[model samples]
Target: MTEACERPEATAGGAADPGDPAADRLEVRAAVFRGDDGDRLRVETLALAGPSHGEVRVRVRAAGVCGSDRHVLDGEWNVPLPAIMGHEAAGVVEAVGAGVRGLGIGDHVVIAWHQACQRCGECAGGKPWACTRARSNDSLLPDGTTRWRDAGGSEAFPYLAVGAMSEAIVVPEFAAIRIDPAVPFDVASLIGCSAGTGFGAVANNAEVIAGESAVVVGSGGVGLSIIAALRLAGATPIIAVDVSEARLDEARLAGATHALLGGPDLAERVAEITDGGADAAFEAIGRVQTMAQLPELIRPGGRAVFVGLPPEGQKVEIDGLLLAYEGKTIIGSNYGGLVPARDFPRIAAAYRAGMLPLDRLISARVRLDEVNEAFEAMRRGERTRSVIVFD
Candidate 1:
């Protein structure tokens, strides 16, 4: 008898070698969204094609439910319909396609959601994070088609090109970076996005130096990671601001020198803490008010880094004269300005060495079916990170 969850049927025009793993279709349970209905996910069986040339297939071991994933569910982001939207994940390689080297089946790997095509001008200019093709909405393979289809044969797009909320996924070989087996799948999952983004923002974007003062607004997972990175960087008087007392407590555990509840006098409180103002301030809450208030948290000639992603069309206004006369700089960081291939390993090593507190960041471990509930918990601000651990 067949199992309760039957395998997905193969798509048309696919009669290849039966013995070749790359030619076969695998059926897996995935939390899928049919559209931007903002409803809970529908657990469905999806047919996933094997990796094509320059691609690798991974059996997802752990996937993170992040704020960005919630944004996609809330229709705050412009994503293709019928999308599988989790990006932060780590797993083991199950299959490898032609022309892919240095990775083989059974290799532990972390999925870097963004895969930069080095041929792009942005990539050549040393900004792979801005690679246009890598952020495509279609989630197309290198050959310009999707590897996923629903039970009805409708195409299923992978969000951010790495829909990791599934039992397995097929991604570009470059998107799957080999990781140490010593790093647990759950810990490695955070390093893929949250850890990398937060650490990169401090180390690369803000460039906060030792003895410098920094304030991180919003004490979510990314915010806590920013706090941890600030401490590692030896930034003095690291201040964390958040509305939730529980999150503020987490911030303190993550090495925040001072934690303050956000209110009307937040700016004044930060000023008093730093004896003037911060050398740099990071806005991890994606809100117009938070983004607008960042410039006021930093002193003259200081930098304000906006690490959160506000919805499109939402605008924030700052004093142009104050920005110009004070010589303050406001910049946006994508993926914490990280080069995943080079940075993921460093982050994993940091976790292994006990320098970065990966264990503290994980608030809950869940199953794939609890993903929607996990997102709700995130919306309620109850978890720093809720990881879906697959068996």
Candidate 2:
């Protein structure tokens, strides 16, 4: 497929100077997934178009390797291929497009994957997180086009609309939420996804209260963030369950009050620790079995928040009778029910105040070329999070 590189007409703020030939295009190194038989990522030089109207060009500093990106790699989530993957990222603004405001060059930003259309009902209703017009999942910009093309001129979609694994990217103005320059890019990268989702699940979805008990299933980055948020919410006995003891250790450091190895007796162990069941349960890994097990891990009338992204077409069978009889609730939280414009700064502030130990979430720092190794480590459950640091 071919696309023209014609610049959109500038608006009030004036877009990247169309006459300045240097501002029109850039050649950058990006990790492109071809969806070939082996499903590996290739670092290729691609042509990156400058930001269009209401967008900004960013030089990616750091991006977190997340499970959602893995799902696309593993063919569980069928996004457009020959795509640039990586959503949770931090970067510096290099240029702004027409109509852009409140952000400019050199500003540090967290790349919010979900660029909600403000006019959508959900967005207008103050729940931009649930905006009906989000197109990131389509891997295209709001205009249904991509800014990346290979040397051969084949269009490459940006995974989740950010494609942050690249050396540089162009994203919607709303997607690039500015933060304090003092925040490290590695820590800032996580606020876009894992940290935001985990914390939002507790504060918004579950409405976790002080002294309430909670259990977090899966001790990955998102799970660890849940533990930290639970602690901040004054929740007691924050139980963390994981199959890997090493991850459980990480969970403890993230503020889990009790750690339990996950297995057949996991429920019994959690019940023992919480004296029957916890007040809330968070399933951060999207395995069907674990998603089904969430209701059992919480007390009657408790909330079960699903923070992880399950493979497309996958379904879990919940006990409807038990759910109705016990007055339990199951909530699916997308992007942590976050409004990037609002929550990104709040998360940064929390990090600055030492309320969120975000640095603990970074288990490894790898270059773009070493990203596959990072994924391997993730497959072996050896990392809380691996960040790809750009030069």
Candidate 3:
């Protein structure tokens, strides 16, 4: 954790201020970068706008480091840059904008990266993640703009429309999913993206059945989360494949009955474990080739899910002759098929019921100032989920 602020503790008394003036600022500091390849996020200060109509000002409590951020940094997911770069987060609603209903100041909430415009056709069609309005030239209203700025006059794009790397941020009311108060912000943070996507892949996408065999490749944060959800859902013979033994340990904790050392025969190992092929297979590393191989690991009529964010222009080739005869299906999972407002609370309730081990997946808790070290740990694959917590 960074030395600048104390670790956030659970409060019994009325929530008290931490006394850090930066905690309340339109002008603030954040890990930022410029250019489409928004890699190498640097610390900077900027003046950001506050909440406006149907928005809220959030004091970011904790934010999990997600692979999509890596994609943004690597320029694979071409996010507009000279921007703040975090999306998976949880926090308190410090201020609610005009017309915001059903939530109030001081509410604990998970910030959904997907900001759906309810009126948009995509949102009307049950695909909020595909909200075309999210990509509009003016995605942020003055209230939706970042809550930080530098001495120079320029705008900073927040990744997935809600960069939570900073001390505070301004987001849409729809982005703030009120969670069970019992859920810690750190655990709730993973619900924002990590748990949402991983678990959603199972519950919403694959709908894995009890006692079914499952495989999750590239067992990082998202992959491990899928494993956790499947375990809770009663999937058996769960196999986790990763190049790193340490992550494999994390996967075991998350609920993988078996961890296979990544190699040429990974698909074979999964097939062998399931006695033919897995009932379902998930690819989370976002490598086109790896994603393409997922179908081969599943049996005929089995389901294959891709959870990774592959780079632009990437393509994966497959053995069509075999797949055509197998009657296999390939599915692209977006945000784990999460319906934010509904799923966040359900996940939180599941956690409070002791049915979910969200804390086990958490590797570390650092203040916003330690954002750089968290990413470094991510680069080395040293952590399952490193959360950046605010005071």
Candidate 4:
């Protein structure tokens, strides 16, 4: 852990300011990213202010380093400098701001990156994932300012506003989805991102029915989650594709009936397995090369879901004429087309009932200090998911 500041409020009978009221702040150790090129994460002590109106402060316990985090680290995604990166996390609520209801300190919750502005058109249309207010990438707080400051008084932005990589974070009350205490923090953390996204891609986006054939490209965390959802939906011949043998093995454990290594002949192999093409195909790898194959992997009148996030501004060429003639559909899912408030708890229930194998998705756990190593492992596709566990 990098020390950015000495422990705060330890002097003079635990007073932050001798003459002032008790400090309403939390000092925490966090992995701070200076820029895209630097592999070294500056562990720093940072101050997190108490939650403001309509917000809640959470003491994060378990966070997953997702592919989105890698996108920023590898300069594939755009984020402000000095970002505290990590979005998929579960924690205990430490404090709730005024006007925040239904949540109290000590409640176990999952921090979602997207929060709906309930009055927005998207919210009213039941597509909260498209709410503009929930998509801010800046480091500013909800009130157009920042609540985090480092030792040098430099402002640090929380990646996607939930910055779960830190020991603590202040997010909108809606961003904190309460979970049952019976669910372990490590398992719940994934529900916030990977599980939700993957599950949503099938249940809400593709709407795959039982007995239909499905092809999932990429066997990483999200990919495996999609495969699990396909199984729950009773999809037949659930095919998993990946270049990594280890990921293919994990895919099989996640309920895939067949696992195939990705290559130039991947679509051909999938066609042979499904006897023509799958009913639905999901591209979870987020590359143009893989995304281009989605249309070819599915049969006529089938749906192709793009669950993987390609780097910003990156485009994949597709057969517009073929799609139009075949009546095939391709859709992009942001955060799995899910409303965290409504979907998270259901996913938790599914996990409890043994429908979603979230435990099998977690391959390793490390302390916050070892987060960079986790990132490397994710890049190498060595694990389905690696979590940062904070005691």
TM-score of each: 0.93, 0.94, 0.89, 0.93
RMSD for all candidates, in order, please. Answer: 6.7, 5.1, 6.6, 6.6
Higher-scoring candidate on TM-score, 1 or 3: 1
> Candidate 4 at 174: error in angstroms?
0.9
Cα lDDT tens digits for candidate 2, 294-342: 9999888888898887888889999999999999999999888887777
Prediction 2 global C-alpha lDDT: 0.86
Largest lDDT belongs to which candidate?
Answer: 2
Off by over 4 Å in 1: 1-22, 135-137
RMSD after Cα superposition, model 1: 6.7
Q: What lDDT does each candidate get?
A: 0.85, 0.86, 0.79, 0.85
Question: lDDT tens digits, residues 49-69, model 1?
Answer: 887776778999999888888
Least lDDT summed over 10 consecutive residues: which range in candidate 3? 4-13
Predicted structure 3, TM vs. truth: 0.89
Local accuracy of candidate 4 as per-residue lDDT tens digits, 121-154: 9989989888787544665555666678888888
